[model samples]
Target: MSITKSYSRPLDFKNGRIEMSYGAGGRAMAQLITDLFAAAFDNPYLAQGNDGALLPMATGRLVMSTDSHVVSPLFFAGGDIGCLSVHGTINDVAMMGAQPLYLSAAFILEEGFRFADLKRIVDSMAKAAFDAGVPIVTGDTKVVEQGKGDGVFITTTAVGVVRDGITLSGDRAQPGDKILLSGTIGDHGMAVLSQREGLSFDAPIVSDTAALHALVAAMLDCGASLRVLRDPTRGGLATTLNEIAKQSGVGMLLNESSIPINQPVEAACEFLGLDPLYVANEGKLVAICAAEDAERLLDVMRAHPQAKEAAMIGEVREDAHGFVQMTTKMGGRRIVDWLAGEQLPRIC
Candidate 1:
C-alpha cells in the first residue's frame, strides 16, 4: 500500500509547522515523505519506495557531484535554496562534460519551520529537476531542534554520464590556451547580500542561478578542443582561474575590461567594499580551450541563452610561480591573488 494512503489524516500543509516526529522514522515521517516529497518529485524510480533507487546503467564514464545549500534568507531575487541546490549539483556534473541523469536530495529541517515554506522549496526543486531532464529519485529528511539549525538546509547529489573521448579537467589547460567566461560574475553573491542586509538599490541585482548543462552540450557540439569547464561559484572567477592555473601548473593573463559585470552588481560591490572578482556566482562558467579554437568555442557559447554575453577574458601562460595577473581597465597590471579569507559566509 502507498504510504500516504495508510495515514488516516492528511498533513496540515497550509497551517502547519515541522515537528520532530516528522523525522522520527515513524508514521509521521513516512507520511511526510509520501505526501510531500513523493507527490512533488513524482517519478517511477522514486515511487519504488526502496531504501535506495535502482538506476539503469548507461554507457560512458559516470560522473557524480554533491553540493549543500545554506544560503542565508532561503529566498532570493531570482531563485531560492531549492532551485539553487538543483543547479549547483547539475552544474558540477556538467562541468565534467557529463549528461546529468538523476539527483538525490537530503533535507535538514529545523523544528518549527513552516510546512508551507518546505512545500515551496520542494516544489521548486522538483520543477528544476524536471526542466533539466533530471529526476530526484531518492532522498532522506531529518528535523533538528529549533535554534540548533537554520530554517532548512538542502544537500543534493547528482549522477551523470560522459561519453568516451571527451576528457575535460582542470589540469588539461596549457600555456597559450584561451580562457572564456560564460557571463557576468558576482550576481548571486550580491543578490543574497542585498537581501540579507535589506539593502535597497535603484537597480536591484538578481541571482544568476541557472542550469548550465545545455550550454556545455552546445559547446561540445561545436567540436572545440575544450580543456576545462568550471562554473565560478563560491570563490568567483578569480579564485576559479587560480585553481586551474595551479592544477595545470601554468599562469594566466586576464583583461579586466573584457570581463563582464552588470552595472548593478558592480555598483553594489563598490558600495559594499567587495571585489566582484572574488564574489560568488551560480549560473556563470569558465572555459579553457586551445587558442586556435577560442573563437569557435566563443561563438557556440554566445549562441546559448545561458551564455549570451560570453567573452574570452584571458589566456593561459607559462609562469613558474603559477600567478594570475590581470591588466586593469586603466592599462595597469595587478596580481589577482587567491581569496585570502571568507568574503561572504553561507554564500551557497
Candidate 2:
C-alpha cells in the first residue's frame, strides 16, 4: 500500500506569527483553516468543507442578522471579542422570537498578530457557539498589513427560523403595553471602557456578554403575546427604546427607579460622567407586551437565571411625537431623548 503525503506541517501555535501568505489562498491558508477554525468549530454541517453550508430548514419563517465587533482591548474582565461576536449576533436573532440555527464568521487579522491569541479567540468563539447549540457552518479569514488594521476584527452573520404564527417587530409596540427589562444595564460598556482606559473601581465590573436565545425561548413559552423584543446593545437602552418608539409610532413612559443597575456599574458611570441609561448591555433584553400579559411575562423572565432581576420598568403611551419620558425618583418627569452622538464607540 502507498502512503499519502500530508499537505502541511504541524502549526507552531505557541511561537508562530500570522504571515501575509496565510491569506493568499494557497496551501498555507488551507492549513490554517483546516488546523485551526475547522478543528475548533467542528459540526456536521461545517464538516462538509464547502464554501457555504446547505442548511436543512424546518417549517418556519427565516430570520437573519449580521453584526461586527471592533471593541477596543479585545479581551476584558468577563469575555473577549470572540464570544462577544457570537453572543451579539445570537441575541439579535433571538430578539425576533426565532430559534437560531447556524452562524458564519469572517476574520480580518493583522500581520504579525500572535498565533496564540488568534487561537484563544477562536476557542472562545467555538465554546460560545457550542454552548448555545448553534454551529458555525462556514467562515473566511484575511490578513491586513501591519498598522492598517486592528489586531483583529470579527464579523458574524446568524440565521434562524421563526415558527408560524409568531411575528415580532420593532413596529409592534402599542399604547397601554407594558415594557419589561431583563436585568441590570451598563455592565458591558463599562467593563470594556475600564479595560481600555486602565481604570480601576472598588469592584471589577465584568461584561455581561452572553447568548440570550435560551432565555428568549423561555419568554416565548409564556405565549406569543410578545409585541416587541430587543437586546439593548451599542447605543444602550436609550437608543434602542428611541428606535422602537419611532418604529411603532408610540411613546414610552419609564420609571427611573424601576430600571435596574449594578452598584459598581452605577459608580463607574458616575465617575466617568456617563449615564447608565445610555450605556450598553450584552446579555439583557427589553420586552414589550400587552398590559394583561405583563405579569405572566415577568414571571417567565424572573424564573430564568439570566433574568432574575427582570422588572417591569415602563409602559407604552399615546403621543404624536413618539417621545420617551422617564419618571424620576424625585417625582420629576424628564424626556429620555435619543443619544445625541456616540456614547461609547467600538462597543460590540
Error of 2 at 23 (Å): 0.6
Each prediction's RMSD to truth: 1.7, 1.3
Which candidate leads in lDDT? Answer: 1
lDDT of the structure predicted as candidate 1: 0.94
Summarize candidate 2's per-residue lDDT along 181-264 as a digit string, tens digits: 999999999998888755545458999999999999999987849999999998899999999999999999999999999999
* TM-score against truth, every candidate: 0.97, 0.97
What's the residue-level lDDT of 147 in candidate 1? 99
Distance from true location, Cα of 312 in model 2, Å: 0.4
**On residues 256-279, what C-alpha lDDT tens digit does candidate 1 reach at each position?**
999999999999999889999999
lDDT of each: 0.94, 0.93
- Badly placed stretches (over 4 Å) of model 2 are 1-3, 197-202
Local error of candidate 2 at 205, Å?
0.7
Candidate 2 local distance difference test against the native? 0.93
Backbone Cα, N, C clashes tallied per candidate: 0, 0
